[model samples]
Target: MSDGANLRGRFITFEGGEGVGKSTQIRLLESRLRAAGLDVVVTREPGGSQRAETIREYILGGGARALGPMAEALLFSAARIDHIDSLIRPALQAGKWVLCDRFADSTRAYQGANGKLGDDVMQALEQVTLAGVRPDLTLVLDMPPAIGLQRAASRRAAGAPADRFESEGLGFHARLRKAFHQIANAEPRRCVIVNADRTAPEVGADIFRIVDERLGDAAPAPAITR
Candidate 1:
């Protein structure tokens, strides 16, 4: 993994509407990459570093929803700035692949497209928050909104309440799905839309194959064992 100290690590982000199995896919990919002798750092947006997590709690806990999408977008960007500086950039600089559950694309989808914030504001926020850092690959997990919401509800059935985004109406999620597809279409080189309605193992296999095909050269040599 450390064969090339100067080599910058790859950044991959998983994106989707509610309950699209992003967390599960991220875990699966992390395991595969680690087994292949790559140093992997798994993180998530709205919260990755400490300060960002605090922002995450506030935003998801419904504190920012009432303030409108613009406020939420700003908060998300603030968290992202901290996340990039505190955790993500450092890990990548050390040659560790960063698998993020969500990133700026979420803001683009939820706030810009669905929230009706317009492209100008979204572009400005993206410029400020991301600087020059962008994901090398983004796996947009595509699935029906109704089915995804059902899965989300099931996951939250253990006496856990839905978060701000999760509590949105079905129409909101439908638009969110469309927004993600639009993003994938706009940046085909950096984004791949994966059908996420299948089983975890099946989805994992496809994701691994995509990673190997697209980034095999950058991956570290598997560790030798006796």
Candidate 2:
């Protein structure tokens, strides 16, 4: 039910800081879509494809941190290129709704905002990497950085150190939240800000409603009986 009805698939990306429960909600939404008799492909950025997963390991393992933000952004873009080529594009062409955990917006928020990369640079990278393919809808889960970090910490295994981004201080996360808000504000039609402080079911219900309102009408109609 994408605006690009000719593409035969809808792309929905979830954006938020760490511990916003994107993975959980993606699974819930996937199940709902399956129950609704739609083919769905759930994937994640920086790791969706086999080659991209290699990049994900290196970047998340803190190997790319010292290389600086610009380098990190380049690496993420490289991964995304492979991800789209190897997985996302094929599935969409096959008429499967694609639910991606994170996408270019994360790069815009994390690298562009925190790394001080200008909008021009970000736009250039997006143009090269995306090549006209973009999510039909983006869900930005909103919550305080303090609460989100605490939730992130609680979910981690004992003595398991934080990943590159998660290890950052509260100020970094606060800025991340602000950046996501700015993205939603700038693109009201393509992005929706959903409060993440509530229970999962509550959040899921709201998400479903939004999805239904936006894309449900475009779902393929059922066949009539003879």
Candidate 1, residues 1-226, lDDT tens digits: the string is 1222343988999999999999999998888888788889999988999999999999999999889999999999999999988888888888889999899999999999999999999999988888777898999999999999999999885889999999999999999999999999999999999999999999988898888877877766753221
Please list the C-alpha lDDT of all candidates, in the order they appear: 0.90, 0.90
Where is model 1 more than 4 Å wrong at Cα?
Answer: 1-7, 222-226
- Tens digit of per-residue lDDT, candidate 2, span 127-211: 8898777999999998899898989999999999999999999999999999999999999999999999999999999889888
lDDT of 2: 0.90
**Each model's total of backbone clashes:** 0, 0
Q: Using TM-score, give the best candidate's number.
A: 2
Which residue pairs show backbone clashes in model 2?
A: none
What lDDT does candidate 2 reach at residue 23?
91
Clash pairs, model 1 backbone: none
Worst 10 residues of 1 by lDDT: 1-10
- TM-scores, all candidates, are 0.94, 0.95
